[model samples]
Target: MDFFNILILAIVQGAAELLPVSSSAHVIVAEKLMGLDPTSPEMTMLLVMLHTGTMFAVIVYFWQAWRDTYFSSGHAFRSNARLIVVATAATGVVGLLLLKLIKHLVAGNDPGFEIEHLFANAKLMAAALAAAGVLIIASSRLPERANGALNLRTAAWVGAVQGLCLPFRGFSRSGATISTALALGSSRRRAEEFSFALAVVLTPAVIVKEAFRLYQSHALTVAKNGTSLLQLVGPSLVGMLLSFVAGLLALRWLSRWLEQGRWHFFGAYCLVAAVVVLLVG
Candidate 1:
């Protein structure tokens, strides 16, 4: 990819990663529109970097809240910490199982671009986006409640929804988890905060997974493609920096908009985006 293409993709990844919109969907669409191959190892590496960048953004934005909620000595803080742990564990279990299922169905027999049913599959993405939109819109309609005071059952449901998002690129993890939490009677701010905290907790595993994949790809490449793996490092770092800056802004905007109950606007936007993608694809 050229500099301009990489710049655009980085911006898209950074901005979309924090929104209730799926960064994966936005990045894939950007790759298609830019005539870039989504299946390239370079592209995959860049994506990992972008994800890491947004992960950092989440950490920076929520540092204070996490300290207050998880590190405080108060009884309420301890209880909230336990609840977050339970929810995070649930999310991990659900996400792993769903990812395994997708792997078996798509990447099991034939692990190639054809097997990449999760990428650039407009129909699937559109449907996933619509589902997420509905959930978020519905959550926005519910009565507001206190932040960070979730019960176990509600936390489990949110975690389960997060797991479902693992296999679908258009299904935003943050959107699903936050919406599920809200639907389960958690307040909007609390849902969003917890969702981000979970992200901070889980991001390292994802980064490690991608790093292992990148290593395997390097060691097992065929003697046909005359590309150097090292070339991706610069682009990946650049993309990561860009994504961090953009993601911070997006997170702030999303938090403000969600608190004001303006999330239906995103739902409408997703509906329109789905229609456009369906027609284009």
Candidate 2:
């Protein structure tokens, strides 16, 4: 891909990744419009790097809040640590199971099947976007509940919902997880904090998985072309940097809207975007 194309994808991924609107959906559509193959190994590698950039943005933006909340005391630290572990465990189990089911149902006996093949499906992306939008709107409309401590049950619920987002491109992870937290009576502040915390935990695993998949699928091609893996991923470094900046800006916007009780507006935007994706994609 050219530098211009990489920059565009980076911007799209960076902004949309932090927002309730799905980044993968937007990135895939952008790739399609630019005549790039979303399922290609290089594109997958680029996507992983873009995610790494946003993951760092989450850390940078949330570091102080996390320190004050999760690390203020020994007991607080332990309790939050346990919650994170449980939630991450739940996410892994549910996400893996769903992935298995999807592969079984979609690929059947095909030996070379991979879920990335579905990343560019406009109909599926639209449906997933609509689902995420409804969930966000419903949660936002619920009556305000008292702010409560993060509990294991709520964490598990949030994680499970997050798992549901794994296989579906337009199903926003932050949107579903944060909405689940809110609908389960968590404060908006806590919901945002916890959702991003889970993101920080989950992203590394996803990057590793994508990297492995890229190697498995494209190692031969790279060898034949006499290209090193580093060479293939070199252009993505620029995209990562661009995405990091965009992600920081996006996080600020998301936080402001969430705090100002405009959370449902994101859902409305998602609904509209879904229609646009369907029409143009």
Candidate 3:
């Protein structure tokens, strides 16, 4: 990949990743437009690195808020920790089951087929984007419950919604999880915080998984091209740095819109984006 393409992808990933919009959808569309293969091992690795950049951005942006809330007291810390664990566990179970089911249905006896093979399907991506948009809009309209608090039930719900996002490229994980939290009666602030907290946990695992996949799939490519693993991933490192900066700006924008009761605007944008993707793709 060239520097210009990497830069463009970094910006797109950074911006959309933090917002309710599906970053994967935008990045994949951008890749297709640029004549890049979204399902390629190298591209998938770069995508994961781009996510790593935004994950750091989330940590930097939310550090103080997390400190004041999750770490406020010993009891608070423990309680929040348990909630995170439960949510993560739920996500793992549901995501794995969905992956298994998908592989069985789609690949059958093809042991070599991986989920990434479906990443470039435009129709699937568009439909998932539209679905996520509708969910976000509907959840935003739900009446807020007084004394809405983050509980085990709410966390599990959010996690399950997140799991639904795993197999579908255009189903925004943050959007689905945050909307689920809101619909379950949690405050916007709490939903935002918890959604990102789950992201921070989820991102590293994804990075590791993609890294392994890249190595497994691209070993022959690397040998043929006389490139080391470091050489292959070096460009992604630069893209990650650029994405980190963009992600910070995006996080601020998302926070402002979410706090100002304009959360549904993102959903509206997703709906429009879905149409555009279907046309262009």
Candidate closest to the true structure, highest lDDT: 2
| Candidate 2 pairs with clashing backbones | none
lDDT of each: 0.80, 0.90, 0.89
lDDT of 1 by residue, 145-171 (tens): 765368888878877888788778788
The collision pairs in model 1 are: none
Best-first order by TM-score: 3, 2, 1
- How many steric overlaps does candidate 2 have? 0
Question: Across residues 1-41, which tens digit of lDDT does each residue of candidate 2 receive?
Answer: 99999899999999999999999889878887899977677
TM-score of candidate 3 on Cα atoms, chains taken together: 0.95
Sorted by lDDT (best first), the order is: 2, 3, 1
Error of 2 at 212 (Å): 1.4
Model 2: worst 10 consecutive residues (lDDT sum): 142-151
Candidate number achieving the greatest TM-score relative to the actual structure:
3
In model 1, which range of ten residues has the least summed lDDT?
109-118
| Superposed model 1: Cα runs more than 4 Å off | 74-78, 100-115, 146-148, 220-222
